[model samples]
Target: MEKYPLKDFMDASEPIIVEDVLAHPRVSEIAHTLIASGLRSFAMVPIAVGERWFGVIALGRNEPSTLTREFIRSHRTLAGQAATALESMRLLENTRRRAEREQLTSEITARIRETLDVETVLKTAVHEIGHRLGLAALDVRLGVDKDLLTAQSETKIVEREKEQ
Candidate 1:
């Protein structure tokens, strides 16, 4: 990974400033590729917030000595703001998923309460849960004393009658 400057910079969580890519020993292996891409100098700032690191913000220039200390400092500030925005988006997505799960549970419970038939309740539960979880099939089993109630998508209901 040391052969790649971007990986090394991200691992160190530090800014990498190369004044001349062709003359830099650290990026020597990729110097020709960088020059072919019309980049003589480049800088990378790690996008991070506290201990969490997202990635690196890389910028390149066609001329050498273009990426100076001031340029890198400004980019570091930009990387910080980007990382904060990414973290905020992640938290919002998690909250949305949690709310969806709670809503599904409430809907299933309400449907179950409206029915007195055990078969209907089991079918409704398995169908809703399987669809929500993207499962191709689902099964549910309930036991009481020596009797058992089973439900499957393909097989339907199978219940043992209670002993008379």
Candidate 2:
């Protein structure tokens, strides 16, 4: 498989047109395998957009000399169209996911602002986030320290006394 003629074309990003699979020097090693698969001639066109190659469009013929130049040209066109369609679909999907994420953020922010209570805010945030992401379970932990709170409270008291 590593030494197969198709692998070379895939790496080279070049179209392969073998008129006779068995007699072709490049495909002689894999001729038996091709014959077993009932292929006398084969062609592969790279489905690529610029330097980004998605894959290959392969066609096999039972009779040699059947894969003509015109046929390969048509196959190349098909491969290009396939690549464009696939790239467009990928871009559309990405845009959809980004829109969903932005909508989820807006919803969570609105719900959080509707309440002043810390517990309500936390619960609303967690629930909205978990539900939006389709999570089985979600948890939030607050690591508030007693010492830190006491120090902060004392500082506030001192500031208030100074202001008064």
Candidate 3:
């Protein structure tokens, strides 16, 4: 039915049901909502990560009808595949970010080793550190003074200064 009832039922609950839908009021409500939403018919299957119901996979049809056993089974299979693919993509993205961070660290370390001057070293270290960790506003307190100062660093350059 527009997938709202199925979605709502999942949001409001944690049960996974795939059998008869017309036998229950909640199921009927889903149908009504679907119809009101301009969908003539829909099939809903509860989606879950293990025993918990996460949501539903609903397919809409213009003409009211029911799905065959094979069709329901096939859609459920597709839903499972989609969920797995989504999880895989999330994992891949996380891995890519970690790799990028590590690569940045390596590159920064190499740059520091290639330079000998203290000023260049400090500047390079700070810049690379910020780059690998993230772009940020940094106040570098060097030497024994540790003098308080506001340093807004973008890349290797500081845009504003407030010494304290």
RMSD of 3: 5.5
Which sections of candidate 1 miss by over 4 Å? Answer: 1-5, 50-53, 113-120, 143-146, 154-158, 161-164
For lDDT, the strongest prediction is 1
Cα RMSD for candidates in order? 4.0, 8.5, 5.5
lDDT of 3 at 134: 72
The order by descending TM-score is 2, 1, 3
| Colliding residue pairs in candidate 2 | none
Clashing pairs in 1: none
For residues 6-39, could you state the per-residue lDDT of candidate 3 as single tens digits?
Answer: 5655542232343344445566756666566666
On lDDT, who's better, 1 or 3? 1
Candidate 1's residue-wise lDDT over 1-164, tens digit each?
33544585354357888889988898888888899999999888877777676777878889897665777788888998898898899889999999999998998888878888987888778777877778888888787886777777655554565644
lDDT for model 2, please: 0.72
Separate clash counts for every candidate? 0, 0, 2
Q: Which stretches of candidate 2 lie over 4 Å from their true place?
A: 1-5, 51-53, 147-164
Residue by residue across 1-164, what tens digits does model 2's lDDT show?
35445676464346888889877898888889899999998888888777766778878888897666787788888888898998898889999999988998998999999999765676677777777887766666443543111112111121111211
Better of 2 and 3 by TM-score: 2
